[model samples]
Target: MFLIFPVLSYGNNITLDEMLNMIDIKNFDKKIYDLEIEKNLSKEKFYNLDSYNGVKGEADIKYDYDKDKYDTNGKLTYGDFYVNISKNKISNDIDNGDSEIICGINKNLKNIIYSKSDSELKKLDYLKMKDKFYYLDKLESKKIDLINLYEEYKNNEFETKLKSNNLSKLKTEEKILKKSYELGAIPKIDLQTLQVSRENLEIELKILDKNLKKIKDRFLYEFNIDISNKTLADIQVKQIDISKYIPNIGERYLQSLDLDRKITIENINYLSYSNKVPDISLGIERKKETHNNTNSENRIFLKVSKDLFYYDVNLENEKINLAQQNINYRKENEKNISNQLKIQENYNNFYRNYIINKNKANLESNKYEIMKKKYTLGNITYVEVMDVFEDYLKFEVEAEKAKNLFNGYIYEIMVRGEKNHE
Candidate 1:
């Protein structure tokens, strides 16, 4: 997203947009979020493997001897006369042994199906995280908070200067009133009222000074910069065509939510079906045996396994129902969010207030100028001019506050994914 700000000298000054740009570079939370996204992407790649096990080998051996085998092993009774050469030697053999070895490899087909489905769900999760990284409205919310703090600091600082000037003027006026009272030209009560007003201004100035210090310290702690040394550039309000302005409904974020819910439902459905698909494995085995004669065999086999007691149909149905409910909740949540944003209405309201206050400040400013002229020509007392000045100052401060609100609103909208359509 792009934000267009005024061309002000930024040598020692920082604008709100500049601070926003710094978030990606300076914010620790954003860095952690980035690392988490990287880790998730790595996990997504790991689930693409085709097999989860390796080849296996097995061997068996047996050795035994029988008393009858040792005594009468090698000759048939009818043909003994022709084949009787080895009977004594065969009977003398004491031990018989057999050995077999088999080599095989196998994989569970059901597991493969389940893993593929799971991988898809993980992929969707990764995508959703990526969307959050880009369309981060939460960052905008943080910016709004910072803007308020900064504006408060500036307003307090302005008030301190105004109060100090007024106090100095009031001190001179008190000296004149004191001289007049001593000469019996003015009442003692008038001199006492001026002293009381001057004291009150002093107290108010002290409070303003304290507030300014606290706000400055808070800014330093939170943003890691001493606001005292750095200048704050004024927020420039753009002339926007309200009709053309569009508030970002965060479509990408909402779509990601919908997709996430769909994937959950799909996963539940997949699990239910996979439970019925029995664990099936296929393998080819090679066997070799040795005894008095050697033999070899090769076979292809299929193995099927089922969870005899672990599968629960009712639990699967409940899981599917819960997933559907979550989807429904998400839809309702989106509608509520739409109603709450009120971007256009908020913008218009702030802008209108700003204009009204600005006009009032201007009007009071003209009146104050006329009062100053009247005081110079001796048509008005210095006290009367000060009153007009104080009134104008109040309006001026209000106008500044209104401007802060207007600028803050625009800034929030910018971060909330609206572009300046001036």
Candidate 2:
């Protein structure tokens, strides 16, 4: 922690507890988790190439920087030399071929970073780490919602069963109609209406069954785990304290931070190895005194020259600026994600209270069942009972939906928010 504090502002030093505090996750799916592992493999491969780029040698042709000093004519001369230099930084000279060659070679080595993505392959496996984490977060949220829905459903199932008993009332009403017809107190037309109404209740119960089945299938599909993929033993349901398992937000943040640090180290390798040079260049020069010297006198001089700063400081600065900018961009993105998490927290709290309260309020309802019995006994009319049945089913679904939402909010706080905190 002390070592890393110097490199970053605010000393983004963290521990497991801090990480746990920042993350909110309720579930983990197999497929998304697998994809995240794959993404890490790819990133690790990307960073591995840094070693090659960091050690590449550059071929440099040394000519007199002050060209006027070398007055070599069209004679055969061993006056020019070339040596490979491993220049590690950017070059100032726009016309410098050696620097260009170095850049080209480095680019060639790191070509995989920008290479064409096989659309089909990428589509099949183009999972980014961030995207995988986000996908998992969304699924967790949705799962929580469905689970809550299931909770309300299970909680209020008694009421729904009670509502379905309206079928008995309809049967009783049909009997009354039949008796009235036999007594000549009403026409047979009323019997037809009563029978049809009885059948409609049967149809509605079937529809409810179908809907519950769909909801179950949806849960299994999203989690990428079969809800039917349970143990053979009839396991007793155990209560879980959701807060105990809310996850360390700070830990997730640090894991992501570690990945980022590795990436940064890899990226910096190309810059680090830009200024390497081989041995030295030795050349011979002829200095001719022009005081009647072209006619008779020639002085031979041995000259040795080496590139003092193989990498151009100005060019290197530009590259450094670009690299720094990229680093800054990623940091900014992380900041945006953190801010969004802050906004989401309040929303979760708000929805939790409202929805959970709605769930509890509807849990002990027997109004539907009681009304159904009264209607069958000729104590209540059809119109009077309709709202009672409807409210029972509506609130059952509403409660479940709310519980899941509350679960999702908690997940976001622990999982999604950790990405930034780490």
Per-residue accuracy of model 2 over 1-422 as CA lDDT, tens digit each: 22322221112332222222322232345445666778667765555443342332333333365542222222221113222222222244443221111011112222233322222223223335445545645554554454444443343344346447767866877787688779986566657655666676688777766765665465444322233332211111224433443344334433444444444444344334333422232333233323222322333333333456565665466566656766766776677567556545665575667566675546525776787688678786655555575566566656555554454455445443333322
Report lDDT (Cα) of residue 74, candidate 2.
27
Question: How would you encode candidate 1's per-residue C-alpha lDDT over 1-422 as one tens digit per residue?
Answer: 11222222235788777766665444445655677777666665655433322322232322235533322222222210111111222335553544455555556667666755375656557565554645355555566678788678767766777779878987987898798879987667667766777888898888998898788777655655456667777777756554443434444455555555655566666667666678788866676666678888887889888886676766577687767768676876677466445777787788898999999999998998898688557686656665776678788888888888888767665565554111
State model 2's lDDT.
0.46
Best by lDDT: 1
- Candidate 1 has a TM-score of 0.72
- Candidate 2 off by > 4 Å: 1-200, 211-258, 269-273, 276-380, 404-422
- Local lDDT at 362 for model 2: 64
Q: How high is each candidate's TM-score?
A: 0.72, 0.42
Off by over 4 Å in 1: 1-10, 50-100, 110-138, 241-246, 249-253, 275-279, 290-294, 304-341, 365-391, 418-422
